[model samples]
Target: MEETRIRFGIMGCANIARKVSRAILLTPNTTISAIGSRSLEKAVVFASENHFPESTKVYGSYDAVLDDPDVDAVYVPLPTSLHVRWAVLAAEKKKHVLLEKPVALNVGELDTILAACDSNGVQFMDATMWMHHPRTVKMKQLLFDEQRFGQLKSVHSTLTFLAEEDFLKNDIRVNPNLDSLGALGDIGWYCIRAILWAHDYELPNIVTAFRDPEYHESGVILSCGASLNWKTNGKFATFYCSFLSNLCMDIIALGTKGNFRVHDFVIPFNEKVGSFYAVDNSKWAERALGCAPEPSELKIEINLPQEAFMVQEFGRLVAGVRSNEAKPENKWRVISRKTQLVIDAVVASIKNGFVPVEVVY
Candidate 1:
């Protein structure tokens, strides 16, 4: 029964890690067994502040956490640039990896990480919390229902938040050396993932970055947008991400017979429940005075946070592998690779003067 309970080691004390650490604690089959940071004091402070289990070990170096024989998995919330290095090492050490989003700087780096995990026979999953949300499952069911939604037409998504002056100036996200992709890697990752999820992970044929991306003095992106085209059937999608706008996370998907929308797609406005709107066969009525069918508001209640659900699902897979009952799931790996591939294409398009860049694989 040892495999039934998966012990986790946290790789960094990033702000996002705080939320995920709570998730590990909340998940039934997972526990935070260790936490590591470059500074021992910082690690200690983080463990204490997050109220990690008293038995949780604190290490001054990330290597120490990976070296722990008791750690069945590692939750890596490091920056995009550091993902390949740490995640690969974690896999090579025979530890399952729950990596943070934008999984890597590009597809090439992600491939390296995936290869390591494959060679070591360990699980790999990105920490895209929304994918585990009940609301997302319901939405997917509706989108796939031909009778209700018909053919998909287009999607528009936006994710933005106003960062304080200090963050704009001092945050690592805007630091070229640390998080060069900036807002694109941070918030934009969610927007791109949402679009892909809506399209059922089909790779776009061409990606074009919107003209005039705003960059910090360090040459890190602060705001950007992109348009994606699926050549075969002419399905198109657009997404925008920024750190200069008021709080907004929205997705609008239109189909031939129905429309779907969610104002808070990245993170629910309230932690306990989330809502989305949908309309089927909506049409004008009474001389265009009103619509015949009104948009329906639906809400999903969550007993545990979405991040917790993500952890629990990851733990289930790890347990299955540990018990010799199943192999590591590559579905999540493929999804992560496709997302990174699109991100790479978008960056390439921006560098090539906004020309359309074909997305290969």
Candidate 2:
């Protein structure tokens, strides 16, 4: 078989796309063939600044990009609500899709996109860049070991950020229609993903949650918490996330035998490494890794930019598609379903006054 270079056409000039576009540029095998935006002027400016070859098309509309027979795949960094809609349309156009996080507002919407991808024989993956991290897999290996956190007991995770003043002014994150799920959708999704990875817990049998209406002033949950109950064995875990709070990011999981913690789990900005700590025999003894010669004070510098990881990984995904190894065992559908399930329950719980909700599988 001939070596294939997955040609890409970016779907929007959104901020997220800026990161992804940079990533594509950094990676060697993937070629960005076109860029699209609602305005031709924006597309032209983006393409020109990025040094896209003259042959590369500057599309004024999404449909025009989709219509390009030369465009084999699309990177959609649109707003939260448009994820499912555009993903489905991209797949219908027979383009492989790498969509940003919170792939849909809910599971039902995710299902529709999944169906479209299946029908069109196109690969669709969620752009939860963190999920594809090398450290994530190693962390999962530790979590799955019975010797690690045997019989998970509880989970505590958080992610938050203060928006830059300039960004807060015009970003869609400030728009009610564009971001129905404020910080919860943006930051909370990672917390939920980490919890599941740590516990190896599938969909929770039951979930109950609450949103701070004060934080919900943006007409959405800026901060949210949820308690999850596992059906397989009645194992339970709790997760909390907020954008309204001061900067904080971490994931701590406690088990019957021991506890494991990850410092600054979400943002791997800079070359700062992330530390993973485990205490098995008891609370007194703690073993650390990822810092220096030894695991000392549960601190690891995760030195990487948010966009750097995603860019390289997207190249890998494109290669996988060409080689027919595109079927990743852990697809975004699982997390999307689990997250939407938890979010739906949380919404219900808040409306019903924090009453526990039994989630439908």
Candidate 3:
């Protein structure tokens, strides 16, 4: 039998890698070929615990996985600081790269990674699972309808989860030397991505960080909020991300004639089914006595989870490249760059005394 499935080598044993490993197995055209960690023993335990196939190789170093001839692609779940180094190495090895989000610490690093992928002719995609949810497509369709949604006016997104004491003190996200962007890089990435997706990836003209950003003693951001504005059309967006609040993921977009809301914009509350609410031409009746109609609840059901769908889409792209049928899909790369550019603007706004920062492309 010809081995047509894309074999993936995982470059880390982070907790999030477990979910992605399951996603790889669930995706039809993908398989977990290798698991790598600094400690070979840790890699072995991770593969066994994650129920990887017996043929999955365990390696002590990330470079070993990249050097493996059988690895057609690599999933990089490493820390933000390591993304550029390892992802670039993987691409240089001619392996497709599926990187986890907050793709990098800044746009400069992301561009470096993208350049490597382009030079090597390998697929590049950030692991933003929600982008693959069927519900997202449905919401986008509504947003594009001229009469149904009108012109986009404003968007507000929030994603916050209370971190445990131990995590607040020791998690990589709070470590300045590791995931230095902190909440903005971790949870805020999703919020930024959602806002961009709502706007069809249009780059905002200005970003202003909300005045009172919370920070850890280590100088890492613990919570923050920002407002984005489009000068040409006057469209605006606001997003808040924190590590000191109760779990919440919400995206509310208001248009001239309608509104749409998604309670779970990052990870759905239900793995198999996702939902959203939308309303068109909503109006009050009889001097604000009552509303004319309630928002419609739309549910999207899928055979596989969103992460698995992400893996499936990435695998298909890699397969296309392997068969010489198509080039690497650049859509995901473009989206990722735009998201990072907004994030960079937010960071600049925060650094420049909460002043508005102009987004440069």
Candidate 4:
């Protein structure tokens, strides 16, 4: 039997969109139906250079892509400031939305987008690719193990990369009007997401932003850190994100009796495999010369990159809804809202003299 194909319309030609377009093309049940840019020539060039199918449409206005009857879903890679407007419109158009993260500048905008999707009966998902990686699932299995791993203790995540000269000067991420959240939105989103994932999506009771976030002259955050505590259970998590440091992506999670370290949590350095170092329990060496029990390196092979896996999962949900086989999954909306709420809390803490802010939702 032939399978149904979910057609995707891309809403921008941003650099990240180029990578996602490839993922859509590689997805088994998804196809690129069209791509739009503010300028017609840019859209045409993007399509040609990316070797898109001849049937793919090119449009000068975003509305054209949303209005296309062939477009069953839209992958939006627009700036953070434009997310609510376009995402809501896409849902209203009956097109499922695969939005790029930060998802929105704040939780209020995210709720507006989610409400539109719910009212219109469309699936909503954020493009946080790491969530779909096989390695992520393997790590979670270990975290859930009661005997091998004890109760969650603490977590620390860091993601940083020095911006290029042009990126530092002209990237939309650092622009006050386009993406005011800046590095916190562009880079820290992953760190926050990792922390929440490690905590089983539990909202923290308090969020305290680390003092003195680096800021651009335009009043946008370039780097920031925050600490979170989950009630009185003593579960703690901290994260640091920046555009001013050497390239690195790390997640160190410690449990009462075990621990693991993910050196490349965002995007694996090796295209074929994602790996981590783990230890269940350890003891001091004889005479206390050094540490005992070497950590084991675990690797998981992947047939596709994390992004393509994300698209495949999103397509599965959209296809189910299109076929009347299932309702849209609300998990995506749930996590995105949680992540955005924490982001809002961080911004509030920074503004309020780095005081601990109680998270309400």
Could you give candidate 1's per-residue lDDT for residues 187-280 as a string of tens digits?
8888889899999999899999999999888899989999999986679999999999999999999989998899998889998998999999
Worst 10 residues of 1 by lDDT: 1-10
Those runs of model 2 whose alpha carbons end farther than 4 Å from true positions after fitting are 1-3, 51-55, 164-169, 216-218, 232-234, 283-330
RMSDs, each prediction?
Answer: 1.1, 4.4, 1.0, 1.0
Better of 1 and 4 by lDDT: 4
User: How many backbone clashes does every candidate have?
Assistant: 0, 10, 0, 0
Q: What is the TM-score of each candidate against the true structure?
A: 0.98, 0.85, 0.98, 0.98
Reference-based lDDT, residue 3, model 2: 36
Q: Can you write out model 4's per-residue Cα lDDT over 1-361, one digit (the tens) per residue?
A: 1138899999989999988999888889888989989999999999998878899999999999999999999999999999999999999999999999889999999999999999999999999999999999999988987766788889999999999989989999999889999999998999999999999999999999999999988899989999999986799999999999998899999998788999899989986799999898788888999986788999999998889999999999999999999999999999999999999999999999999999987
Which ten residues in a row are the worst by lDDT in model 3?
1-10
In candidate 3 the C-alpha lDDT for residue 274 amounts to 95
Can you tell me which runs of candidate 3 are displaced by over 4 Å? none
Question: Which wins on lDDT, candidate 2 or candidate 4?
Answer: 4
